[model samples]
Target chain A: MKNLLTSRWFGLFIPLIAIGFGFFAGALIMLISGNNPVTGYVALVEGVFGDLYYFGETLQQMIPLIFSGIAVAFAFRTGLLNIGVEGQLIVGWFAAVIVGISIEAPLMIHLPLAILGGAIAGALWGFVPGLLKARLQVHEVIVTIMMNYIAMHVANALIRAYFQESGQRTAFIHDSASLASEFLAEITNFSRLHWGFFLAVLACVLMWFLLWKTKLGFELRSVGHNRQASAYAGMNVNTNIIMSMSISGGFAGVGGAMLGLGTFEYAEILSSFTDYGFDGIAVALLGASNAIGIFFSSFLFGGLQQGANNMQGQANVAPELADIIIALIIFFVASSYLIRWIYSRLQSKKEGK
Target chain B: MADILQILYTIVPAALIASTPLLLTALGGLFSERSGVVNIGLEGLMVMGAFSGIVGTLFFESIGFGFASPWMGMLAAIILGAVFSLFHAVASITLKADQIVSGVALNFLALGLSVFIVREVFDRGQTDAISARLFRIDVPFLSEIPVIGPMFFSRIYATTFLAFIVVAIVWYVIFKTPFGLRLRSVGEHPMAADTMGIKVTRMRYIGVMLSGALGGLGGAIFAITTAGNFSAGTIVGQGFMALAALIFGKWHPVGAMGAAVFFGFAQALSISAQQIPGLAEIPQVYMLILPYVLTILALAGFVGKAEPPKALNQTD
Candidate 1:
């Protein structure tokens, strides 16, 4: 009984239970709203898997979520919460668009350069708060929150000044700079699914390798686990903090680049936040802050997002109902102690039997 | 000189109006933080408060409580705000969840639940504008004063005055009362407080509830005075700005009020920038970004060391 309780699998079990509870609560909410929970859930499932186009849309949604999830999970492993992923993502999208327009080259050079530019911009944005926290002991949460607004306004101004194509959005990037793959599109019935999906998968693998195999990753995790002990053991805490944040920001930057280059092929001015960064927090928590876990969690969240429109249309459930369910999932996951307590009681009952 | 006075006339009253919500919310944050429980969900709480306030007012007006509907709305907001905040308190205090994550979760829940209810009830994303907005009134004796009267007393919201009064009350409660001492002790050193027979959990709960009450009132004021209706964007980033004010003010009620006023001045300037000579040349986006930049700089210890409550995010 004790072994089962202490096993590594228990960590995975708690989140599953939390998700189960979340869905149950969602069902209750639906019932109270005078809707059939079964019908709504079925409609949601069909929306994600009804046709090739729906599947493509789901995959497309998963791409940025995967990137953002990895970004958040990496930061968590390094003992940081990168709430400014939204800011980094916005800056990255802008940088990718800037590079896409300014540099006239073949796809071989232009696309990679645009993507790299985005990563670099996001890295720079992440570096500022990381540097401040490491050097001056300033709290990262408030700084990151402030940075999100600053990034939004700056991005808006930049789009208005340099990239305005008539309305709030910029002109589409040249073909060479685009990540839109015709082959993938044709297979998916012309959905927005693009090469960025491959990039997202690659990022997850890279995250795993970097965190588990690399010496720097070891140092970063040590610093995150015990800053005082790590510092005493000769790890450069400041450097690792900056490195973790920069890399985390780079991941979100890639997500933003995927949005601009693959999905929309242009940067649009936003009056409010895109919310992917905030959603990344929930994903990282549910995924348990691991590469494989984040990938799966992102897929789930992505499916929920894609399925929400269908649920609203077919079942008369508000799209925001999905958000409420996601929030409840997070709430349940946050209260892991409750899950642990419940598991212990069940285990004791089985032992007595 | 005349132009400067003219700008002041336009900016000062606007600044006071803007500062009211920030001051109220910051005071709410002050209470929660003082009890060692950080409430980043102030934003979410404000949203709930604003939504409930408008909805309550609309309902009361429909039922024929014409002149008293706004007060009833504020009352509803306070009750709902406190109830909603209990989720954060339970998650953070009882469940021993990471306070920041729980707070963030509360934010998502508040926004989602409020929007969902709005759609379910109104069949739209927003409610109709409430007709029972809180009106501004001039103070009897104070309005007769010279230039200062118009600037500070004339045509100001009663809620603004209420916010200032609450600031004083909070200051007195936090610094001068035995209950305040116990609350501070639990926040700073829960184990020590426990050893001394102070109920740490109870103190923290009260502190969190106090924040909820003030936050709800702040949201109601924002809805009644500024938004006049409940919408997703009504609360906007005012709750966050109030948080900044909490930090900038060094966690003291009077200090937070001062900080809120400073931010309010910045916000007011942003709104009226195009009307001001020479300020018209600069882009409005820069003005919008200024307060956030200032907040970041303040937090970075450029202005001064903004020390937070000890053991603020620690789990018992």
Candidate 2:
């Protein structure tokens, strides 16, 4: 019974059940608010999958989420919680936009350079907290939270000073630096579905391979699992910590580049957090901090966010319901031990019968 | 020199008003962290309190309890805050979930739920301004004191006095009481506390609830004083600032209060920077980012390593 409950497939079942409960709680909230749950859900489903345009929108939403989720999952595997993904992502977005606008090169060189600029900026952002934690044992949670605000302000100030074009946002990037694809746009009925979607998928695959197939991945995971033990086993814990955070930040940086070079092709002044970073934390948690799991969960979150507009317009359900449901889902996932206990108890009962 | 004093007079009152909320919320954080459960959801809890406080005030006023509305609003905030915090308590203590994740989830839930309710009930993105706000009060004899009176007592919100009184009570409860010992022990060494018949889970639960109540009061005070209405941006990052103050104070009630005042002074400076002589040259964005940068420096142990509760973030 224990073995069966501990099986790999059973791990997926816990999140599935949590998702179900989350939906149930959301439906109850709707009912209490005097809205019809069935109509609301139908609108939600149709919003994400009704037509090619809707499906494309959902895919567009999924791109950044997938990158951020992978970023967070990667850091978690190294036993570090990268709450600073938001800061890294914002810095990355600014770096990509700056590079995209400044340099005028051929498409082949310019696109990659812009993306790499973002990745490097994000890596630097992640490196600060990583260095602090490694040397001083300073907690990353508060530091990252602080860095997020600083990053937002810094990004805003830089855009206002250098990149502003008489609007709240910067000038559009050069066409050669953009990730938008004409063919993909035509196929999706002119939705903003771009080449970044393909990049997101590639990132997931890369994360899986890097974590499971490489010696450094093993060292990173070992350090995450047991820092003292890893140190005794001759691993340079500080270097690995910095490397893990840098790599994780790189993923988020690319995710941020998707926003700059794909969806918007410009950077806007942000008065508050973009919320993608926070959403990434939820996605990583729901995905159990695994690459493939992150991909699927990102799609789920993307669908809900995409559908929320329709739900609010047609069913008279507030768009905030999606946020509430997502929060509940994370809450349930955090309580997975209870789910495991219930699953094991039911398994034992079935065997006894 | 006279101009400087005039600026200080305006800034000091603003600082007192600002610090009141932080002082209340940081005290709440101290309680939860002392019991070994890191409640990063203080921001969310504060949001809930602010929303509900306004709602309660409006509801009571509509029913013709105009004079009693604000106090009633505070009471409702405390009840709702305690209820909302149960999710954190269950997730962290009973289910043994990751405390940070649970706290973050609570923040999301609070923001989403409050916004949803506001749209439904008020048909707007934010709640209507409450008619009966907690007004500034003048102390009888204290207000007559020459320099000290105007800066400290006159034209201050009752919540500011309430905050100081709460701090003294919190200090007494946390230091001089038997319950405080058990709560501290549970945080430091839960296994040892458990073996000593102290009931670590129960102590932790009580600590979290106390935090919720105080956090709720802080939110109520913020709503009544600064915001005047509940909007999505009303609690913008203050809860986080309070968390920073909690760390800056090194997790003590009096220390937390002192840190809260320091943060409040920073906030006050940012608001009135143009009036100040030297700070007028810097961009507002730089001033806005100052508190957050200071928070990071504080956490980096520039003031000294702020030791957290030993069993903090550890699952049972």
Candidate 3:
């Protein structure tokens, strides 16, 4: 039991150590720029948890990240590199926002329908890479990246032609039919956290079940572990590969919808989809592609993202330094051996006693 | 007859200038991949070098004829670019992290860091335009030839000729030299190379550093020739195009040069395609996106997996 605890705890330590190293390096950078690192850090901490509103904003910022993280994490389990999550999320967000605005239905149907529309749209985007990978043996990395540009241009062009406003955003959704009611907003101070947090959690649970408990999960894992052996064992390698990406894309798309409908309400034309897709990759790595790990990692990432503004406002540091920290975390997680070495050394010391 | 001469003159130089960066970076990737490292961070390194070169030249301007400053700036760009790539090397080579993920992280880091520093330190979203740009050099005696002379000798930047020279040097170093054989051995079979006294780690380090140098040179050329300034989006997807060129060239030096020229021709035509008589009616956006679309087609197996170096995808 003790060994298991130590072993299990080390998984979490990797991200923690990465965070430490990133901060240490950031401090060095701050010193070079002639700023006090301590004050910068304090500002960051306070910015995320300074007040009730700040805390709520943190949760709001975390909503899409959590969902996208789960999406990427789910694909990671199946050995699929779903780099197109960004594209899928944008398509999903477009569908969700369009449905949210166009519908006049009651709250329940409108909300669920919007979410479903977004998920289905994202799944379709995901399906292209899956099909190419499965049928033509194309690398998903290249296809997903190309899909990102395609999704961006297509979305931008459609928004301009069909949905342009004085600003680059769509018309606001009807108040009565919004995902969150005014009464709820009054209580929560209009935080974007609405019910999407629960949806993200539910998606995580769903992914866990789909990856572990089902016969399909077994086939997918087998294929991921060794495709040739799985093929020899008569499993449908191509189908499972496509299906994994499809489901992964579906989850990411819904994550996008959660962002647009639950928080921003209007689909604004962005130069690029907020880096949710890329952030999702980082989140999945930090989570070790496990459901609970994903949950905690999402919060850590979400908090850092939420705190970036505070870091900027007070510390005289650029908000982008937060990205540097995030990159460092992902870098360390990828090189997890550094953490393992520390863990083994620590464990031996504890055992020697 | 005048119009025919004008068309040929315009087309040839445009092809050479447009392909210069592609040729340099593709050759860079050839060096890295042939020695067993899948370097997808070429784009990020290029951006870093672009920014560094612009800044270097900006500060060093007022030197004679804009010559010493830009050359020094190019050197500075190469050094900074190589230093930037250490992040990738450490993460992938030392940490045994997933190379693709590390590469992606480098891209993000480069984008955010460059933008942030430029915004905060420079008080603007981008660097100042460089004053000292590379000058077009004409070969003294060679400019007299009737057809090919003007195309090759006149109105060419010094770096374009340097790129051609580098290609020859890279090809020689890879195929005809002892160091090249050892590097190739490490990439082909690290375990065997390790037993035979070739240092796998050191070889890979050299490969990555060389990639950084070439990527920087490619980026510096971009700043001098086309952009003439370091700004956001100055190098949008040029690095990825170089990656596509490398793969299309089947991971060979001369082949990559050919592929780079081909891509460059396509890119040049895409821009000029809108200017031509029959093609003017087409949308400009489509022209801008043609290279990316073509890259997807290429990646989709216009060139099959003619097997990358055996150790290229493997980690030590």
Candidate 4:
């Protein structure tokens, strides 16, 4: 039992079962709604795998999910709950667009700069909450919630003030700042695949490498495990908290850049949230907060996002069904204590047998 | 002088009306937090309440209970909201999941489920605006006061008065009653409370359920009085704002009420500022962000370190 508790495969196994339960619940929902669960699921699968175009769209969705998932997971690693990822992503999106619009440089210089610009903006957005939590012992949850609103309104205002185009969005980003690749696009049959895919995969690798292969990561995880113990052990808990938050925000910001430079090519004013940052929470939880786990979980979230649209189109299912499935997955994953308990019961039963 | 008086009348009543929902929801938060559970699912509960409130009203009206439909709807919302909150309770309290994660899941579930039901029933995104909505009533004796009457006492929804009454009742119950003491003790130190023979788990459950009821009432009041309908967007960040109020008020009932009113006043000023001479010059974004910024500042110890109950978020 103890060995199973410590096994890494056990971690992966739990999430797989949670995902299975999520699909099972989704099927029940489909049946209850007078829609055939099989048809609904079939439509969901075909939506993502049917064509190169749909596959490309799923990748486009997955890129942001990956970055945002990292944003949430990185913070979770350092004993911080970054509910402000949406806000950070918003600021990063705008900052990236601002850089893309203003900077006239070579592709080598401009694209990375725009992406960096986004990271900085997101970091700044996250810094305030991190500072408050570190300094005043204020709950980060409330501060992050407030920050999300501040980001939305401030970003909208900035968009309207300086970058108001004829329509709702900013002017198209410069060609040099674009993440689009003609090669990827042509291969995907004119789908919105771009260089953001590479960046997202790199982000996953970066997170894995930074956390598993560094001393700072060790210190951060130590703090997460026990802040008092870490402080007694000569770790600067406050600094670690702030650093984790800023890095998390930077990851989320890159997600914003993916949308601004790769998918949309312009920044639009938002009344509602982008949903990527929020969904990242679901992804992070579903992934068990591991880099590889985040990669796969993001694929699930991303596939659902694109597939649900097709389900709505072809099978007449609401795309919100995707959200419902994700929510159920989180719930199932969250209640793994029950799973563990059930496992224990089964173990006892086998012994009795 | 007359212009100032007129402005006060419009803004103060508007502020009170707006504060009603926050006041009710924050009180609910107060119960849950004071009992050691951080009800981040306040937002989701309100969404469930909002959906049910409108649906209940429509059902009541269809059954020929025309004038009483809104009240019935409010009752229905409270019941449904409390039941919906069981998901959170089971996840956090029973299953011992991460409270924050569970809450976030509930928020997503609420929105998704509500919209799914809407699509199923109306074949559209929003329900029809119910005819029998709650109305503002003039306090016959109080409205006749020279200056303060029109601003504070006149033309308010009955729900607003009920909310204030609820605040007083909650204050009394929390500060005076043995049950409230047990709940607070459980939140403060579950082991200690358990040692003292207090049913910590039971108190926490009651606390969470009460929050759900109040949160549901808040949602129903907003829908039946202000929104007059329900939809996907019905309860957008109000739950979080109410949570802020609960924190800013430092887990005290009256304090939370004051914080809620303060928040509402800021909101009212922002909305009514376009008519005010000097304030109209401020950017809309600044106006919109004002309440949130103030909440952040208050939480940053500017309000002198609003300490939460010690065992908040711990599932004992």
Q: Model 1 segments beyond 4 Å from truth? A: A349-353
Where is model 3 chain A poorest over a 10-residue stretch in terms of lDDT? A175-184
Which digits, one per residue and each the tens of the lDDT, describe model 3 over residues B1-316?
7665666576677878889988998888777788788887888888888888877887678455366788888888889888888888887887788888988788777776777777677766678777777777788888778777887788888888889999999999999998899889988998999999998888888888888889988998888778988876887767777887887777888888987888777766766765566667775556545555665666667645534687766666
Clashing residue pairs found in predicted model 3 = none
Rate residue B172 of model 2 by lDDT.
92
Flag regions of model 4 displaced more than 4 Å.
none
Fraction of true interface contacts that also occur in model 4? 0.80
Q: Score the docking of each candidate (DockQ).
A: 0.82, 0.82, 0.56, 0.80
lDDT: worst 10-residue window of model 4 chain A: A1-10
Q: How close is every model to the real structure, measured as TM-score?
A: 0.98, 0.97, 0.89, 0.98
Candidate 4 collision pairs: none
lDDT of candidate 3 vs native?
0.80
User: After best superposition, candidate 2 residue B176: deviation in angstroms?
Assistant: 0.9
Cα lDDT tens digits, model 2, B1-316, are 7788778778888888999989999999999999999998999999999988889999999999987998899999998998999999999899989999999999999999999999888877888888887788888999789778878888898889989999999999988999988899999999999999999899999989988888888998899788889988888777888898899899999889888898888888888998788889887787777777777777788877788999999998
The candidate that wins on lDDT is 2
Give the TM-score (vs. native) of candidate 1: 0.98
| Stretch of 10 with least lDDT, candidate 1 chain A | A1-10
* Cα deviation of B161, candidate 1, in Å: 1.0
Q: Which residue pairs clash within candidate 1?
A: none
Task: List model 2's recovered fraction of native interface contacts, to 2 decimals.
Answer: 0.82
**lDDT of each model, Cα atoms only?**
0.89, 0.91, 0.80, 0.90
Give lDDT tens digits, candidate 3, residues A164-201. 77589887765533565454456556665677777888
